[model samples]
Target: MNTSQEQAEQLFAQSSSEMQADHFDTAEALLVKALNMDPRLAEAHANLAWLLDRRGSVSEAVRHYELAIELQPDNARIHLNFGATLAELKFFHAAEAAYHKALLVDPTLPGTWCNLGALLAQNGRDDEAETMLGKALALDPAHVAAHFNLACLLLRKGRFEEGWHHLEFRDWYHPAEERLRCRRWKGQSLQDRVVLVMCEAGFGDMIQFCRYVAVLRAQGAAQVDVLSHPDLKPLLQTLDGVGDVFAMDDDTSASDWDYWVPVMSLPLYSGTRLDAIPAVIPYLQAPADRLVYWRQKIDQLSPRPGLRVGLVWHGNPAFENDAQRSLPSVQTLAPLWRVPGVQFFSLQKGNGEREVKRFQATQPMTDLAPDLKGFADTAAAIEQLDLVISVDTAVAHLAAALGKPCWLLLPAFMTDWRWLEERTDSPWYPQVMRLWRQPTGNDWAPVVAQVQAALQAWAQPVKPAN
Candidate 1:
């Protein structure tokens, strides 16, 4: 090899070592230097693209991927990475073409097939997705992501039997979840034993599954301790049958617990069925002082003699499915503003908070988000509201956990499995919660319109006694 080629190869090797160590900045710098030295280094370009895509620079990654594929057109790995970046950017057609090309180049790539399957699933092509993911598992039986994706698809279709079984692959990907010193509780008798239920996934997931703690105790667990997110500590403490609650990051390896169980896994072992869900409402409660303060605050404002409604337009932006599940802005909810007598309070925080100011002049909605420190705070505020209208956020779960009247505005495509399809009410919290699903498209207008109509009827003045 020539001197320049040798030097470029050395730089690429160094970049690979840096990447393995997760020193992304150093890896990126080395890849850039290697590419500058030899622009035709397709592997370096592909690796750089992968790094950029992982770091969320999808457009830049796409450019690099295109260049890499141009240099080495038959590389299936390049095509797979390119397709993933395209999918992240929501270029569905381009992504599909890229995945097809990858399959044509190398049909045996299990990861590529899994990626294609997931993409099809996200686009609502479920039958095709199932076939594609089945092909992935046929090729490599232990493909964790394929199993997880298949499980999600099955659960969404309400095929709970197979779904719960496949959902076990989740622990394979998140090994930290299974790094317990104690044995896994597989619904074994806990007559004289303590059980540690570790919280997993998002705030909404924790809230949804925490109800099982009481069930565990009822099933004869002597003591049930929970390891959960720090933010949920205050609220989780109020739950019945809970012996102790520890934060997720707190050291618990030294703690004495006879067995460990993931909060989400409780359903499978406990034989939780759709018909037999522990629908015990109000499993969570807020501090008395906090609830009183919010009640007094609402009384002091004294808006009108109508329903007090809380609104959340967005969820965590960092969530993988946030693009499909979250509303673009509070402006999309404009129709709700015209419902006379009903006072709207903004419970949204972070990215969409500025939109409240934009609409405050015209809509006259109160912003309560600034004072909401945690789920406990949100729970207290929700206690004072007559109803909560939310966009698939953690606060929605908080409202439902508090057994407050909640109306969830859900996106039509790729909705959460917990909501299930073709259903308006959640079995998890029935009677108090109603679902408003977006039509099978990207538009939120229909959802907002339906909510507006419902609010209009709900806000109708009561007929006075003659």
Candidate 2:
């Protein structure tokens, strides 16, 4: 008869194989059986936690991680896993302590160094993050997360040359889209060549980087086609120098294009520098008919409103970083309601649209989201607004592309790479944007107060500053 320890080891080996084959359900069952046989099996608990985390049972995973750490106090890997779970839960300081402890237990672990470095970078500790990431790279030269983290740190510091170079390693983290089979564009001659530029990331990223379509044309590309989300097709068609906007689901052959490039790579290939950003205003246009329709709708709804201000309080909740990037709710935006004579239009979409009704009784705002079909409709509605005040979302990008004034609300931590660091103005939208940053630990009161003051000033009649 096999001893309990020997039987548990066999079960664990079988579970490892199941997990490697992507049979998560079987793997989980086996892990549970193994843990029952050997209650003190720390590795079994750790493996189960990883599977649970992947399956979105984060709270359960955290419990398992805690149990694993308790069973094996000196296991550096378990500590590292515990740190990752804590970070995911937004327990930043505790996560840092866990990472530090893991490093102390095993100074040679490159991954621990990389995770600690990335955590530091997210919290805005640049110098120490650089040192930690550098140490990770020294230990394992090909560590992708270390390279990506270092790239972001450099970019934040305005070291574009080195940053872009390091950014090329992002493919290791997320490989470039493989559907398009064509030669990749590398800033060489585009004369008489047809280049397909793909929108590889989020909606905001697409809007921000699609300006490069016009830049590609200026570089003598004969035809510039775009493969992007279907929702953007209507609006992208209006962008300058774009020819034949294709939906991402299109089964078109790449044989038609001489080369292709990911949209995110455009800034790097365009040789963009901080001082020389392609800051041309009004690169996108709303449909004339839609613009007229929205204008009429707003006029009939609020016949003699003083200032029409559009507000977006939340972004897509499914986004991984939504905890840091998104706001609590429209309820937190009460300060904006206090600014008299300013008519608030709810430009918020998704599940958050219901939030408007919650405030409508007391706040008295117009909800424009129900009639808005897609980005084209949103763009048209934005054109009619006096100003757009939004949390970081596609609407802000839409306002920027339309060359309309926008007040962009940013979180104190994990603001996007495009926003860079510190200054109020954005290089991408220079003349048409203002930024309001949240304080650390998810505080939005200060940012809302700033916006309230600015809105009051904007609503007033023209007066020269002394």
Candidate 3:
């Protein structure tokens, strides 16, 4: 016969194993059972809280975290995990306080220092962030997260030299892609060489970085091919100096290439600096037929025609930071419809499409999404529009890449590293873009108000887009 506490310990260990095996429900049940036998099982409460956080039961997770802290006040890891959850929720100050508490409990924990540094960096505290991250590295030189966090901070501050050097330690590439057969290009001579530019991260990342292909051509590469998401093939195929555009699922022969490099690494090899960013316009183009087709469709659908403006209110919901990056709904952008002489076109699909339909009774906006299949069609529709107004999604990147006037709405927190620190203009897009940032945490109304004011100004006969 085993003691009740011993039984609870066994269940706790079993729950951890179940979680490792991806049996989330089973693990949760075992954790609950363990806590039933021994209510003071702090580890079980902490693990259960982490599971709740993953499933978005944030209130319950917070309760569990608080209880776990009550049960085990000295548990540095519990405090650390709680901080990570708070950070993800964009509760920045609370997360920072939790991290500090963890550091006080155990100053030796490198992840606490690393997490605190990353949270600080997200909120524009670069100097303090660097110090915290440096302390993490000092405690343990091989800390990967500290190295990567510092890299992003440096990159955000336009300290490209040190940023790129530390970026080499960053590790989020597909293993198979990393082991490609061809020699990796490292700023070597591209004269008469056939090189492959492999897609690295996200849709927006690919679109933003694909400008590197032109840079390679300028460097004397004879033939440069690209591998990217299937949806981008139609648009990227139209790029100048690109030999072939194919999907990762398509047949690719490794022996035909002289050198291959990840699309992102191009800047490192090309020796890009703050003053030397390549912003040549019209790097991407829609097919001539599709462009004509979309223009005719737009001419028909937009009944109250004036200045054509494309609107994208949302992005992929699966993104970890989607809660911070994406809007609440298409209705959230209802203020834009009030702008006179501007024809609104809905470019949103998937997650928030219902909100587009919800506005049918009150508005005369054109729904262009159902007809848009992939990026190529989206690009075609965008080319037909005079200006594009979008959130920080791939559509914004596409519009900017097309050399069209784009107004980008930026979130207040976890504002991506690529945007750099607070200037209203983007160097990557140069003359064709404007950035409107939120005045404070997660409040987009004032930002939208600013855009509404600007839109009213833009509608003046003097500044017509066409």
| Leading candidate by lDDT | 1
Q: Candidate 2, 311: how far from true, in Å?
A: 0.8
Task: Tell me the spans in candidate 3 whose CA falls farther than 4 Å from its real position.
Answer: 303-305, 462-466
What tens digits encode model 3's per-residue C-alpha lDDT throughout 1-466?
A: 3599999999999999999999999999999999999988998999999999989899889989999999998999999999999988778889999999999999999999999999988888889999999999999988989988998898888988778767766567656465567888988999999999988779999999899998999999999999888889989998889999888778785448899888878888898898889888879998787898888888787754488888888889897677777888777777887988998888887877777788788765788999999998999999888889888899999999998899998898778778887889999999888998887889889988888889988886775678
* Candidate 1, superposed: residue stretches over 4 Å from native: 172-180, 249-254, 464-466
- Tens-digit lDDT track of model 1 for 1-466: 7888889999999999999999999999999999988999999999999999888788888899999999999999999989989988889999999999999999999999899999999889999999999999999998999999998999888887778877877763256656677888887899979998888888888999999999999989999999888999989999898988998678776789999888888888888776788989999999776898888888777555778999998889898878878898888888888888888898888889999887778886898888888777889989988999998888988999899999998887789887888899998898989999988888998888888999999899779999
Give the distance in Å from residue 418's predicted Cα in candidate 2 to where it truly belongs.
1.8
Per-residue alpha-carbon lDDT of candidate 2 for residues 1-466, written as tens digits (9 for 90 to 100): 4599899999999999999999999999999999999978999999999999988899999999889999998999999988988888779999999999998889888888998888888888888999999999999988888888898888877888778767767662134466666788888899999999988768998998899999999999999999888999889999888898989777776448988888878888999887878878899999777888988888887777489889898888887677667778888888888888888899989958998887678775889999999998999999888899998998999998899999999988788777888879898898899888876768998988988898988787787989
Worst 10 residues of 3 by lDDT: 170-179
- How high is the CA lDDT of each candidate model? 0.88, 0.87, 0.88
What's the C-alpha lDDT at position 205 in model 3?
92
TM-score of each: 0.95, 0.93, 0.93
